[model samples]
Target chain A: MNELSTLANRLAEKGKESGNGFPFEVNPIPGEVEVLQIVIEDREELPIFISVSEEQILCMSYLFKQDEIKSGKENEINKAMLIANISMPLSAFSLIDDQYVIYGSLSVNSSLDDITHEIEILSDNILESIEAMREYLN
Target chain B: MSLITKILTALRGGAREVGESIVDKNSIRIFEQEIKDAQGQIDKAKRDLTEVMAKEMQAARKVENIQADIIKHEDYVGKALADNNETLALEIAEKIGVLQAEADIQQKAQASFENHTNRLKGMIKKTTKALADMERQFIMVKTTDSVQKATAAITDNYASGSSKLLTAKESLDRIKEKQADLEDRLSAGEILQDEFDGTDDLDEKMKAAGIIEGDSKAQDILAKLKAKQG
Candidate 1:
């Protein structure tokens, strides 16, 4: 538990350095497992919730603004829809042992393509770093 | 030269004879002795007045001395009272009163220095015994210790109990953080909807199963599931 907290603190520091507002909070409920909630800037009031189990990190659900959906172009909204659809599956992949996920949604005004591309690249780098750590540990 | 004139002449002759007898030597001697006796009586009265005057002067001096002593003692009593030594003040005051009473008694007694001195000594002895008793009581009270252990014990208990509560609260804070994390996950949709949906169903199921006592247990099971996954 202490190790997990230290890792979360380091991730928060990195997020702060990248000019992203660190809006993550760790909460634990007795008889329940610990969860990490991250709210991204310019996103709707609904936050992304991640549940950390002994074995996996689970993506429970998401909430979105109806106005944000209606105001954007069909193509833009489609891209956002695709991202939302892939959110759970991607989170599941990142939940596997030694995998770190850096996930946040962009505002409607922002291009999803750019955000998705950045996330993919960042994920690759994070995966590579994790692999390196695994090799070093072994 | 009538008969009445002759009677008057005879009376005058008798008065003249008696006067002649008084003027004789023996009569003169008796007069001198009576004059000496009067002189002795006057001398004795003068001596008695002088002795009485001397005694009055001595009594006045004694009264003045007693007044001075009383004044001095009163000043001491005043100072003791100011210092909050009421027992000592009272002792001094009582001594002064006794001395004053003795002085009054001496004034009424026969004018004898020895008698006055003896009375004064007796008064001094009585006052000294009274003052000693007061001193003994004061000493006893000053030395005895009052119990303050009960007060200290209560204060110690409170301090220890407060410390225990503080430690428990600190530990409780850790569990509180875990509860907050689960709430956040539930809000963020990180957990499957079915899990929480199942929580509501469990509540109903517990009520139906005649397991009212197990309701909390069931809730605990749900919370544990949420917390474990989180």
Candidate 2:
């Protein structure tokens, strides 16, 4: 038994020296779809979110420029959401069963109308995210 | 009473006494012969046991010597490996492996011989017990009959058998030692390598000979040699 232990130790040391490393802390999820969460300080600089299962960047969302949100027409928020939806292949987010939610607030100085428009825009983006996810599943 | 009646009675009495004496003498002779035979058997058994023990001891000594040689070779290999001379180290390692295998084989043979010796010893013990019992019976008969026998049966049996047993044992011991020496030499590479190498056909030969399954190393070696020749 001691001899076996010694051999195991030697092999482990060899493996470490070879520089092959595992990246994620894999855990068993309750349901079929795997989950990944990323937190950022500022929504505008949203980093690319990669799905661990599919090996692709699934979502990229950034805060809209303040001037465009203010000067644009009423449907601008929905347009921005639609653009974000079309940017990525639908297959990228299929691993997420729940609504793919993106949470961020408008700048404090922005008007009530601007905040409302941003919320609407975010909702449109959510719908587009769900549709993209469905396409991927099919 | 009449004189003729008295004379007839006296003659009958004398005849009866003579018959009783003859029967007593025959019983004594038979008992003595039995003791002699039992003693002879004990002697033979002792001799056989001695021979077995001597062989066992000789095999043991040879095994010890081979073990020492193996340790030395192993140490040499370890030193070579430590010195980073991997080529030399590997060569020594291979040699050590072969020597170890030979030592293992000899050890097994030694164990077998020891077991055989033990069995022979058990037989000798039983024979000795029988002889002792026979002696006791003979003494009981002598006391009851008031007969003085001339033969020192016990002493003669022990002396003759023990001496032969000792001599045979010594001879077997020497033979075993020689066998061990030959094995050691083979391990040390003193024997020709070809002698060990040519035994691959052993299985085929064993099959042909109808020796389906048994541990006959000598036969295996012969078979291997034949295979190599072919």
For all candidates in order, the CA lDDT equals: 0.44, 0.45
Model 1 TM-score, 2 decimals: 0.25
- Across A5-44, the per-residue lDDT of candidate 1 in tens digits comes to 5434554444345434333333222112333333333221
Candidate 2 residue lDDT tens string, A1-138: 233233234433432343333111111112122222222212111212212121111222222222223333425544545565446433221111111224333332444344333333443343345343322221
Q: Put down candidate 2 lDDT per residue, B34-125, tens digits, no spaces.
A: 88887887788678778877887887887788788888988898898889899998898888788778878877888988898787777778
In terms of lDDT, which candidate is strongest?
Answer: 2
lDDT of 2 at B29: 88
Model 1 native-contact share = 0.00
- Residue B217, candidate 2: C-alpha displacement in angstroms: 99
The DockQ assigned to candidate 2 is: 0.00
TM-score of each: 0.25, 0.31
